[model samples]
Structures are given as C-alpha cells and as structure tokens.
Target: MVAWSVCAKRIALGGSRNWILLLVVFVVYTTWRETFPDAHSLKTITFMAKMKPQGANRPSQSIGHPKIVQDGYQKAILLSYMRGGTTFVGSTFERNKDIFYVFEPEWSLIFQTMNEYQPLQNVDGTFQDPVWIHDADETVERLIQNYLYCNISGIDVTSLRQRFMLEARYTKPLYDCVRMKRNKMANCVKNFTNVCTSKKFRFLKTVRLRVHAIEKLLTNDPSLRIIHMIRDPRGIAVSRQGWQEFYQAKMTFTFGRVCAEMLRDIESVEKLPPEVAKRVLPVLYEEVAENPESMVEHLYKFVQMPYTGYVREYVKNVTHAAKDNTVGFSTQRANSAKTAYSWRAKISWKLSSEIDAICERVYKKVGYLRAKSEQVLRNYNISLRDPHISGSYVDKFRQFRIPP
Candidate 1:
C-alpha cells in the first residue's frame, strides 16, 4: 500500500495503546534499518530497486516518462521557517510556467481534522506522546514522497480552506492539472497515475518540517533536491514578534525554539556526504532580495534549470519588481530590497543582542554581520538606567528564559 494510506488507515483504525506501542517500535526499527549500521540509505535503494508486477496501491516501475530528454524532470523542495521568506522563494518557483508547485502541503488544512495530529508550533524537539511522534513521522514521509512523484491527490490542497490559505494563487494550474488528467470514468485517478509515471518539474514548499525529518526524507528519496532558505535571526525575531502566535508562548521559549531549529538545519546540511551534499542549495533572503538578477541566475544553475529567456524575463520583471507581496496571504511584501535589512532600523539594540546571543554562530556562518554595536549596547544600557526610556521600550525577554 502507498505509505500515506497506511498512515491514514492507522489513524482511522485507532488501535489500542498496545498496538500504538508496537507501531512506535516498528517505526523506530524501520528508521534504524534505513539509516543506522551503514552510511548509506537502504530505504532509498529499495525504492529505486526494480519493481515487481503492479498491485493495488503499488507504484509501477514502468513510469512512462522519457529519461533521456533533459535527464528527467526534477523534484525540489524549499525548506525554511515561517516569516523567513518562504512565500517569497515559493513565489519564484510559481512563476516558472512549467512547474506544478504546492505550497506547504504539510501544513494543509486537511490534516487539521486528525485528532492526534499536533502542529509544528507544539513540537519542541521531542514529543511527550510516542504514538503521535511515530504517526507524525510516517505522515511527513508520505507527504514528501507523494509530492516528489506528483501524486496530485496526495498533495492534499483541494479543500476550500486550502485554497483560501494559498490566497487563490496557483488554483488554476492545480485544477488544470486535475482536469487534464481525468480518465474515461471522469475521475481523478488517471491523472494521479500519469503524474506518478510522467516526468515533470515538481516543487514542495514547507516550513513546518525539521532537519531530522529532512534527513529521513533524503534517505527515502535521494533524487530530491533541497533549497534551504535562511534569514537573519534579527529579522526573524522581529518579524515573529509581529505575529499573534508569537505571544502565545513567552519570547524566550518561542525564539529559543527558532534558534535551535536554525542551528540544527545548518549543521545537518554541513554533515552530508559529497554525493548528497551536492543536492542542497542554501539561499539567504537578504542576498536574494538585494541582488535578485545575479542570485536568481545562480539558483537556476544550481538547480540545473536552463536560464531561458523567459525565465530571465520572469526573474527580472516579476520576481524583482517591488509590489505588495503581503496582499492576501503572501508575506513577501512591498519594496523587497528595502525590506531585506530594514529589521536593523526597527529592532532595538537590546532585542537584537538577545537574538544575537542565541543566533550569533548561525548568523556569522550564513554571512550576516553583527547588528549590535558596542555603542548601541552602551546607549541601551544608558537607556535601561533611565526609567522613562526603559518604560517606552518594554523588554519582554529581559530575563532570557532558556528552554529546558
């Protein structure tokens, strides 16, 4: 059976506690079998293995797509955190007329109905419930594979809520894909099958997935290329502070989680072997915004896409133009270049220092200079001693509550 169906079945059956325990053991064993006791991935090799006769829920080896023409279409992912320019980069991919792109399928509203499924906001490095953890892992793996293979149904963005979430963008292409592939039965099944076999460019943009999840994904599908997007932590902290959910938890806990994930993501890519390492391309938001023309061309080369005249035109006219990107649900916002480093002008020295204290190593590693100067620190201290200035700028994270 397809892996997602297996996960759905498990959730539907709602097995007893003991059954859940067994499932955890099975997931752990499978993860270990694929990753441990060896440097390479057995699971990925198995997927690439020659296929047997087709059966229900099994993918056929005879994917009818031609492999010789352009070395087969690519499967790419845009990996980043929320408010960290994911929408901006995903928009770049959307402008590619040939690509069928899905934005944050993992965070689709379809999964909101799953009772035991908790969102990324609640995941803090580990889960207290083992059953949910295992379930989450399997679901993520299935979603990643489904998108790579162009399983449209598995993309899970058909609902009205999902369309609204995407701000009605890309809906025409999404439905056109479904309409074009309808079979004699007037059903969507044939297109799903065709997409499975047909070679085409597919991209999945997500923010909720962690680095460990990405490692497991690579283990299962080595063909997938990752476009890891990073931003200045000061920018992230400043942007997140504007979000309503940022105040749901204390600043220390919320920002600490962000820093931890950022560190893990950077380290994960750094540790990959040469073969797998070549598949990852890290893009900085500031760099992309500052120099879209040069950066976009480099991205094309990195992803092995031709810098066609149309693509160049798109990058120059659409991607680089200043517009109100925050219109509807998008966050790219107006004046892209101006907004790239505007956090420096808005965020206070004390808050920037706190963000730097946690994100110093990652910021420098990613080519971002320190925003907090000694003079800024001195001014901040002088203000802190002044009751009037201190009251004007409330330091919510003054205590620096570190996560356990």
Candidate 2:
C-alpha cells in the first residue's frame, strides 16, 4: 500500500509538469501566429531567430534592442543641412563595402508631410514658406531611430516608395525585390534586414533632423555617433541658387532660415552633457574639401571605422575626376577644394555682404571669418576659415554668447 501511494504522487507531479509545458508552447505559438500572420513573415522571423546567438532572449538587432550594446557593429548618422555637401561627405562611408549606407531616409517622411499642405506661393511664383508640420520634429526623430535600429518592417510601404530610399547602394537588392510582381513586400523587407544586420557598420545621412532632436537616441545607444556637417552660409546660398527649386524661393528668407538653424544646432551641441557631447563630432565642409584624406581619416576614427586603402583610392579618384557640372546633384569634382570656395566668385559683393550680415551669429559661433570686402571675397588666396578653430564646441562657443 505504501509503494502504490508513492507511485501515484510521482504520476500526478509529472502530469502537472507536462500541462505547464503545453501551456507555455500554446502561448508562444499563438503569439507568433498573431504577430506574423503570413508564411513569409513567419519564415523571416524564424530565420532571424536562428541568426541570433544561442540562449539569447532578445530579438534580432534588426528589430532593435532595448539598449544598443555593441555586438561587433556600430551605427552612425551624418547630420547636415540641405546642400551642405552631405553627398560628398557621406561618400566616404558609402564607398566602403563594410558600411551599410542609407541616404536621405527622412525624405519619405518629409514627402508625406509636404503632401498634406499646399505650398504657399509668393506673387513671383516662388514658395513663400517652408512646408512643415508641427509634429514633424518628433516624427523625424522616430523615423531616424527606426532606421538606425534596422526596424525595416515598421516603416510604411508609402515611405519605402520614395525615390531617395532606393538611392543607397546597399539597398539595391531590396529595391529590386520590391519591384517584383510575385515577391511579397515582407520578403523584401526581410532582405533589407538581412543585408543591414550583416554589415559591420550601419550609416544614415540626413538633412531633416536637428541636434537636440536626437538627444534621446544618443543617450540610449552608446554605440551611436553623429557627424555634424556645417558649410559656409555663403556657399550654401550660392549652391541653392543653382538649384531651381530653391532659387525660386526668396534668397533672403531661405538664407536667413539656414543660418538660424545652424546657430540653433551649435547651441544644442554646447548644452549636451560631457558623455553625450563627446560622441558628436563637428566636420566643417570647407575643411573636408580642402584636406579630404586627413578629414576622411578623422571622420572614420570618430565613428570607430577603419580608414582603409580602398577608401583612400576612392577619395582620390572622386576628387580628381573630371568636373561634371551638367548634373545639379553630381558629386564629381575636378578640384574639391576649389569647389568649396567657388561660391565666393559666383556671388556678387552685395549678396555676399548681405549673407554675411544675416549669418553673422552663425559665423561667429562656427569660427568662420566673414569676407569683409569685395576684394577679400574674390581673393582665393585668403582663407576665410579660422586656423585656430578646432572641432571643440567649448572653444567655439567661448567667443560668443547666446542671445536672450
């Protein structure tokens, strides 16, 4: 009788353990089915799961981690204003096979927002005001964060259809897949995730976001870094004059707004904590064009990427390539340094002075010397950049006070 009682108790305990296991499996299967309703999505999830390290409880890096911990990869953003030579600077990363580069990922968001508002026009047919929404700042921040985290599936199909989204060399495969009639969009997104996660470095270049806007991302992701690119307002204004879309807009308003944004960005960087501040590196566009090799090396080091021989060769080829002026968006240049200052000769003395006055605070904050006279503006020998100006925000901010 005693032996039978012991056996009965053991059977009951084993049955309870089996019931618990079955319950857990049911919940997991049900959750996965609800989350990924399609077969392709289920396959993608399984593939991602298999790619993760053994015993890992977290989702794949493409889906994002709660906090970014470096797992043999780093993420970075090249932050700049429109026509601020972002294409030239971003090429340093884009040329490298080891880096996964996404160009102007924010364009989709910008496009969507712009569509909601009819562009206000002036009597002369130029746009009177910039097309923007009140919540655009927050929305742009979230979009950038999603891209950096490789949350490709979270992005809407409409956003993915933007022309600039297909411009990145790394995204070509996904772009091709998206165009196929039989291919599921989920599979295309899965392809993007696979390619993105396989790289040692993931990079994004954008002109839409502000410095303070990405503070949350910087604080949360230790592996993330920012390359803040600034160019002379005179040069930017001149460059915009060549582009019809911008030239149509009143030059004064466009130029003034650009400088205002630059000043605000400088202020935002100055207020960052030491830990967060150190991750931000300011790259002057003129300096980079002047010394491509050294600047590229410094940029790579700032982002913890290797400056390879191939990168050096690519820079040499692009900077030395025959100047292509036919295309407005061409990145090719015969003399990059010359191109940096070409705007000086293009703009009239009156225009240059007006721009200088408008961007005076920006020039002071960024350590750019204003062209005091027409002769000075036209003289190529005299450099407008202050040699003492380094990438240090504290040093730059020491000379000027923020206005009340």
Q: What pairs collide in candidate 2?
A: none
TM-score of model 1 (CA atoms) = 0.62
C-alpha RMSD of each candidate structure in angstroms:
15.4, 21.0
Candidate 1 residue runs with Cα over 4 Å from true position: 1-71, 109-131, 153-161, 164-199, 219-222, 243-249, 318-325, 328-335, 374-404
Please state the error at residue 111 of candidate 1 in Å. Answer: 6.3
Q: Which candidate leads the pack in TM-score?
A: 2
The C-alpha TM-scores of every prediction are 0.62, 0.75
In terms of lDDT, model 2 sits at 0.73
Candidate 1, poorest ten consecutive residues by summed lDDT: 391-400
The TM-score, computed over Cα atoms with residue i paired to residue i, of candidate 2 is 0.75
Question: Model 2, range 1-404, lDDT digits (tens) per residue?
Answer: 57646655665688887666656666876754442222234445356445533322323123233564555668899998989998887877988889989988877566545433323232122432222465456556767876776777766554454556666788767767766769878778888888887887889998877887787778778889888899988898888888765363588877888888888988888888877777887777887888887778878877888778998988888888876552755678899988999998898787788888999888777788888888998999998877676754535432222111
